[model samples]
Every structure is written in C-alpha cells, then in structure tokens.
Target: AAMDIRTLTDDLSVTGQITQDQLAQIAAQGFRAIICNRPDGEEPGQPSFAQIEEAARAAGIAARYLPVTGADLTDDKAAAFAGLLNTLPGPVLAYCRSGMRSATLSSLAQANQDHPAA
Candidate 1:
C-alpha cells in the first residue's frame, strides 16, 4: 500500500491516494494524522473516507475527511484545513486524486487571516 509521498514542508506532505492498509504505514512513518482530500465514490475502486478513518483509528492515527475537488478549492477550506492541522498531531499527510489539490491547499494554508485570499 506504499506510494511515493511528496513532502511539502516540515509538517506537511501530499500524496496521490492511499489504501486502508496504508494508514498503518503512514503512522509507522511518523505521520500522526491524515487529511483525505479525495471525495468518496470519486472512482470505482477508491476507498471511502469512512473506511480509511476506521483504519486510521485502528492504527492510532487520526484521520479527517476534508474532501475538495478541483472546482471546490477555496481559501476558506484551506483555512479550515490549517486549523485542523494546528489541532491534530504533527507530520500530517493530505491525499487527493493526484495530490495536486492537497498540495495547493497546503500552500493556501500558509496564508493568514490578513490575507485569507492568498
């Protein structure tokens, strides 16, 4: 279930997609949390957020479904994502269909209240 994960910063990384079993591997790799940017039923074989959440819970890693498709990406979602990161354990991994949405969101999260549109 391992995939080539892209580390974006000290505490953030983006991944294409992950399987249920990959949650354990993510924990083993020192990622304390997961943000699923991919929506449920996006693809025929893609695992749902509920399934991944169950695996993450069993692995002792927190997981949240913050799904965002390309068209749905917004500064508000990014800010919310940042808030989630601030509250969750460090070294979080955010995964989307191609990791692009997650990566973009991570960058947007770096913006602040003064420039939420950034």
Candidate 2:
C-alpha cells in the first residue's frame, strides 16, 4: 500500500491510511508531526491508534489522534484540529481512511486564518 501524501499547505499534508513502515518515510520527508483523523476499529483490519502512535514516536515524529467520522465535523473538533496545526512543529502530515476527513478538517481549521492567506 503506497502512501500518497497530498500537500494542503507548506506545513500540512493529507493522505489515505498509511502503514507503520511509512512513518520512516514521513520522517525522511522532514515532517515533524502526524495527525490521524481516523478512529480505531472504524474499519476492519486497520492498525490501532496505539500501533501507529508508537511507530511515530519511535521514528521521532510527533503524533496526534483526532478521530472524526466525517458525518459531522463539529466546530469543537475543527477547533481542536486548528489548535494542533498551530502548535505542532511544522510540516505536519495528516491521514484518515480515505483522506477526506483530514482534508476537510484542514480546510475548516484554515478558514478565517492568516496561515494560508499569506
């Protein structure tokens, strides 16, 4: 399974689900952090959040889990996503089951912000 990273901003990119082996490639890409938007057990045969997080930590990449079902993207969740984007060290990579959740959250968080406007 190839992890295709799609850049949404200089500091952020979104991608479909990735495997533990891909964490090293992400780190090699110079991404300082990873933001996961998929929930554990949401899909069958998916890696648990703990597995991914541990792999990220071992590779020296910061990791965050902000699961959103995409059925409803509440302001609070979007706000939390924004906060992570603001605080996480730059060049972050976000991923979800299909990448839509990650992309949606990134856009919502960027709304009315100066980061992408500049």
Candidate 3:
C-alpha cells in the first residue's frame, strides 16, 4: 500500500515508509521537521536511522528519532513523544513501517498532555 500521511493535529504530520529520497521530497514540499517512530534493528533492510537523519539534515530539516517498536508504546513512550512534540518545530512529519504506529503515538501523546494529573 502507498504510504499514508495525515495531520493528526495542527502541529503533527504522520506518514509511512519514508525513504531518504522521500525525506528530501518532503523537505522540498515544505515540511520543516521529521520524526522517525520505527526502532532501529527491528527488521533487516529497513533504512538506518543515521541515513534518514543525514538526509534530513542535508535537506535543511530538523530530524529526531523516537524509535518506538510495536511493543514499546507504553506510557513512557507516549510521554516522551509529547515532550518531543512540545519542543520540535512544526509541521513535523513522523513515520513508522505503516504510519499506524506513528499516528497512534501522536494521538496518545496529545491525549496525555490534555489530561491533568489527579
């Protein structure tokens, strides 16, 4: 399936299977930041975090790697994601293997931020 890109909120853009070349394309298309949600070493042949980071930097975009595996989306991950979103410039593009995880993480982060502690 083609990669999906969606705006979960005003500041976050989520996507799937973003290549180094595609990162360049996204930069050209005016995206200012890129956040990678897939963990390194999960699957053989997946693009390295360094490769994407280098590409994003060369393209004049800020890059951040949060790297949440399928099993790692706990409260800690959600909190960290929220922290990153609060600091990173938008419109930020976050990606995972299928973008589902990226979108889920972003939504969870937003929810966590919206709710107050008891």
Candidate 4:
C-alpha cells in the first residue's frame, strides 16, 4: 500500500495503518520515530505493535505505542501523546486504522501545548 503519510507539522506526520515491511521506507523518509495509535487485534491481519516495534528497532527507528479508539481520546490520552511527541526523535510518524485518530490526537496535543490551562 502507498504510505499515504500526511505531514501535520515539521516534527510530525500521520498515516493509516502500516506493516512491518514499511519500516525501511519510513526510515528512508527521514522519520526518526513512529507512534502506533491503533490497538492490537483491531482488525484481522493487522500487525501488532510488538511486531512493528521490533522491526523499527532493527531499522534503527524509535517506536512507541499509544493505542486508542476515537472515543478513548481523553485529555489524558492527548497529554500522553503530547509527551511522546515532545520526547520522541523527529520527524515522527503516527498511525492508526485510517489516520483520522492520529491526526485528531496530534491537533489536540498541539492545542493543549499552545494553551495550557492555568
């Protein structure tokens, strides 16, 4: 499948689900890290986070798993996503089932970062 990666910021991009085989291509794209937002077993034939993490490790790319369904995107989850974005080497690529969840999380993270509550 085409990567279909969409850049959300200089440091971050979002994409639909990816397979382990795609790690090399992702690394070649200059991304230093990956975040998997899709949960394991969400769909049949989907690669588990463990599988992706291992592949990423071999490819010399950092990996993080912050799985969430659309309804599970609470403020705390967004905060956690922000933490990952801040600490993970960039540019980072975050992916979920169709990319929408990842994009939504990225936007929430940015908004919270820009306007922290007093």
**Rank order (by lDDT, best first):** 4, 1, 2, 3
Candidate 3 per-residue lDDT over residues 17-117, each given as its tens digit: 77787877888767889889998877788898899999989999898889888788877888888888878878888998888888888778777778945
What TM-score do all the candidates reach, one by one?
0.92, 0.92, 0.91, 0.98
Model 1 sits at a Cα RMSD from the real structure of: 1.9
Which consecutive 10 residues in model 2 have the weakest lDDT in total? 109-118
Off by over 4 Å in 3: none
Question: What does candidate 1's lDDT look like per residue over 1-118, in tens digits?
Answer: 4587999989999998899988878889999999999999999999999999999999999999998989988888888899888998889999998899999998888856546443
Q: Quick one: how many clashes does candidate 1 have?
A: 0
The reply for model 1, stretches above 4 Å from the true place, is: 113-118
Q: Which candidate number would show the highest TM-score if scored against the true structure? A: 4
Quality of model 1 by C-alpha lDDT? 0.89
Which of the two, 3 or 4, has more lDDT?
4
RMSD of each: 1.9, 3.1, 1.5, 0.6
Please identify which of the two predictions, 2 or 4, would achieve the higher TM-score against the true structure. Answer: 4
Candidate 3, poorest ten consecutive residues by summed lDDT: 1-10
Task: List the global CA lDDT of all models.
Answer: 0.89, 0.89, 0.83, 0.95
Error of 4 at 49 (Å): 0.3
